[model samples]
Target: MFRDSLEAGARAVAAHFDHVLSDAADLPVLHAMRYATTGGKGLRGWLVLEGARLHDVAPERALWPACAIEAIHAYSLVHDDLPCMDDDDLRRGLPTVHRKWDEATAVLAGDALQALGFEMVADPRCHPDPLVRADLTLSLARAAGARGMVLGQALDMAAERADAPLDLQQITALQAGKTGALIAWSAEAGARLAHADLAPLTAYAERLGLAFQIADDILDVEGDAETVGKAVGKDAGRGKATFVSLLGLEGAKARATSLVTEACDALSPYGHRADALREAARFVISRRN
Candidate 1:
């Protein structure tokens, strides 16, 4: 139900952007942003709404900000799949933006989507509080910046060509910055938008993020492209540092279980405020795609 609600919200936002952005023929960039933002399974958006549910915030209000999170996620993937990055051709079973469109268009689309995410939160209809909107923008920016997701990406790439070697700690650190940062931001953004304190939620999201990454690493080793919707075994093939590569398959699975336990404990204070969160944590480790 939460995911369905978020999808409805995103459709509305996409329609809104399309209506406003259609006048510029020279700027196919805007259309690319709209297309990318509306795609995918909406895991990040669901996380935002789940966090907001903990605060008892209304779904309509949560939906718009959640849409913002989805936009940021979509933008990140577009850039991350470029030739300079992962060079991935497929994403969520569709050709990546760069492969479907031109490389320059893909780059511009990612840039525009980033701006659109912040703009959506700033819109008065989505958030009534200026301070809350500002906080969301700043928090999302930090999540996307060098200190967070980008730093993680840089670390991930550098580890591939590093002179020495990467231990489990280094691999985990990279995952924390890359995957964990955005997951943390999703929860933080939702909590702050609802005027709720995020101390416990932040802690829960941290563990949840780690668990999510561990599961991803495991899937890379065990999953096929039909199930994963992307290349598998490439991490090991390229000598890319990963939890599975360092910890072995069973060890990585064990670590994922431990993180899930830690995440569940962190949400104990919320009681039922975290029901959706708990479900999401379970889903994170168990999902095939």
Candidate 2:
């Protein structure tokens, strides 16, 4: 059920992107923007739609923010895969944007995607209330900017340059920014749209985000490139500190399981209506990629 919903959300977001960018000038950067947004789990967008559904927001109203978050996510991946960043060669089983095209094109594509994300959130289609649109835009800016994801990425790069690897606490804080920030934003988006209390979803996302990173660390240790659709064991190869590195494989897995439990527990207020989100937490730990 979760997989079906996830795929549906992915298709919805992709179609929206296609419609929005169809009239964009025919250029390599525009093509790269389309290519970079293509293919992924679309987990962030799914979270937006599901959370909005839980809040009784109409699907049409939810779709705008859903695609907006996905665009932001895609832009992050494009920049993260650059030679100056993770320097990855593959993403979603294909060449990274920087590798498929030039670094300049990849940078411009990411920049455009980021701008498009903000534009989507601010558009009247996202929410009729201008205040709601402003809130979404402001929150997304914080999530994707220096105070959040960018902070995490900068810390990661700094850790690579430091003489010593980051300790467990440092890595936790880093991952919170690098990955958790956006996921938290995605999970909390519906509540924002509906003007509901944000505490419960915030709590849910905090635990889920950490668990997601821990699962990623575990996959880096135990998964294959073919299954994971990217390089495996990169953390070990680089001697980077990760959940698995600090806690050991079994301990890391245990932590993730416990976190998933906590994440589900956080959604108790929503009762069975949140069952799919609970399942999503479980799937995060079990997914091959």
Candidate 3:
């Protein structure tokens, strides 16, 4: 059911940025953005729909916002793969935008996609509440900007230097910003869009976000390139701070499991309405990539 919902939501906004480069007459960059955004499993969108499901809102009504989340996520990945960033060449089993095109085009495509995300969230089809739309914008901005993902990236890059070694707490803090913030925002934004009170949901997303990162770290350690679809051992090679670095492989996996348990417990208040979300928490730990 979740898979069907995710596919439908992804297709709904697949052409959302279709006119992105129409006036400029350069379709490839726009195509790159569309391609990157559409092909993912739509976990972020699923999270939004799942949150709405917890509030008994119709999944169809949540599709536009779900697509918006996916657009933002895709844009982040584009930039994250830049030479100055992760310098990755592949994503989702395809050449990255920068590698497929030129670095300049990739950068512009990422910028365009980010703008498209805000535009999609503001679209009337998503919802009627302007305040809620503004909140979505704010939530997305806070998650992507200096106080969140970018700042975390900065810290992560800086930590590579021998002068600064991240303690376990610091590693947690970094992942909370880099990985957890976006997940929390995705969940909270969905609940807010459904007009649900967000306190418990926010806390639930917080724990789940951290769990997601811990799982990612564990994957980086145990997963192979074929499974993860990116380079393995890159974290350790780059001296990046990871849960596995702070705690051995076994300990990191334990941390991920504990957080997944806490994430599931947090949703108990939502009862059966949160079944998809509960399953998603489990999926985070179980994912191969």
lDDT of 2 by residue, 170-204 (tens): 99999999999999999999999999999999999
Off by over 4 Å in 2: none
Give Cα-based local distance difference scores for all models. Answer: 0.80, 0.94, 0.78
RMSD of each: 2.4, 0.8, 2.3
Q: Pick the winner on TM-score between candidates 2 and 3.
A: 2
Q: For candidate 3, lDDT tens digit of each residue in 192-229?
A: 88677888778778888888888888888888988688
Local accuracy of candidate 1 as per-residue lDDT tens digits, 72-106: 88888999999998999988877888888879999
Question: What's the TM-score of each model vs. the native?
Answer: 0.91, 0.98, 0.92
Ordered list by lDDT, greatest first: 2, 1, 3
Model 1 poorest ten-residue lDDT run: 1-10
Global lDDT for candidate 2? 0.94
- Decoy 2 TM-score against native: 0.98
Q: Highest TM-score, which number? A: 2
- Top-scoring candidate (lDDT): 2
